[model samples]
Target: MRYVDFTSEELWKQFLPGDHLALDTIVKRHYNLLYQYGCKFTRDAALVKDCIQDLFLYLWHRRNTINETASVEHYLMKALRRRLARALSKSGSMEGIGFLEFKDVAASPDEQLIQQEQKAALADKIKKCILQLSRRQQEIIYLRFYLNASAADIADIMQLNRQSVYNLLNDALNKLRQHTGAYFKPAMALSIILLLVLSQL
Candidate 1:
């Protein structure tokens, strides 16, 4: 059935019909993206992974009752966000919920070693700057820039009004600029700042 060739919505439709292959395909396609997004909300990789597993299981079990959706990625992300929040809330340990730890990738060879080291240092700096923002601000930046979510999509995912999303995003960017002043160029673009932030992810 070439499940790999199916669009997300197509896979979703197949899944609704109790097709295990379709469900597996859906998981394989979205797992990495979901895991990365989930990690931005919490540092516990295990917890993020568990929530994603549970999310898919819940969807599979409730396939008959779940309505169709135009955007499966958005639906899954919103569900996972809610699930993680509930789990964290019940544990009463939301203190370390906004940081993404830097991942070290090995340099290919000595010639590029210096360049890789510089990039790693910059990524670490951006990660620290992001960690200093409020949880909501970090999330807003992640959604808007990392995911390239439109203001309306972010409003839906974060459950904020579009205007509020704009306000929060503006405030977050302002704070990021101040925090990054030591390393940032006076005219560096916000998109570039975010791209550097994503380098570690």
Candidate 2:
């Protein structure tokens, strides 16, 4: 049968009925988005890939029992987020070991060198900033920017109200700005931003 581009609900109907094509499309649609979010959650490419693989397999096995959700993207992300968070919590992996498989990052020698330097700087800042975040806050940020999730979508996925997601994001961004004021160029301005963000949160 020819595959059709159907709404998520239709896709779910097909999926639960064991339509292999539907399952294929579902995986293709969300794989990259899911993987990127997974990477942000744990910074380990392999683990994230493993987690995604496990998730897809679990979904395949349980499709008959899976209920329809308004947004499949949100559901997959939520499931992936929960799994990654649980894995991280259980392992507490802090050994500076990377989990991502930066595929053939082919670049000119100069470009590669510049990329490495930038990556190192960003990594340092991220490590410091991440350590300052509450677990909930960290999850929110990861879901929002990394997964490109909308506030409404995230609120649904995270089981929080829309206002709560905004508040959490605001509070987390403020904390990060305060802690990383050194990079923000002006301590006074950064402080003001913090106060504003805190107020919003």
- For every model shown, what is its TM-score relative to the native structure? 0.78, 0.60
- Candidate 2, residues 1-201, lDDT tens digits: the string is 555558756786789878878888888888987886676556578988988989989999998888888788888888987777677777878423222222222222234323555434433454466566666676676556545679999887777899999998898777666775555334343333332222222
> What stretches of model 1 exceed 4 Å from their correct place?
95-129, 178-188
Considering summed lDDT, which 10 consecutive residues are worst modelled in model 1? 105-114
Kindly list the per-residue Cα lDDT of model 1 for residues 1-201, writing each as its tens digit. Answer: 788899999999889979989989989999999998988777789999999999999999999998888888888888998899888887887742443433443323233323555545544566676666777777777777777888988899887899998898888777766776655554544645556546657
- Candidates' lDDT values, in order? 0.76, 0.66
- Highest-TM-score candidate: 1
lDDT of 1 at 86: 88
In candidate 1 the C-alpha lDDT for residue 130 amounts to: 65
lDDT computed for candidate 1 = 0.76
Q: In candidate 1, which residue pairs get closer than 3 Å at backbone N, Cα or C atoms, i.e. clash?
A: none
- For model 2, the local distance difference test gives 0.66
**Cα misplacement distance, residue 139 of candidate 1 (Å):** 1.0
Clashes of each: 0, 3
Against the true structure, candidate 1 reaches a TM-score of: 0.78
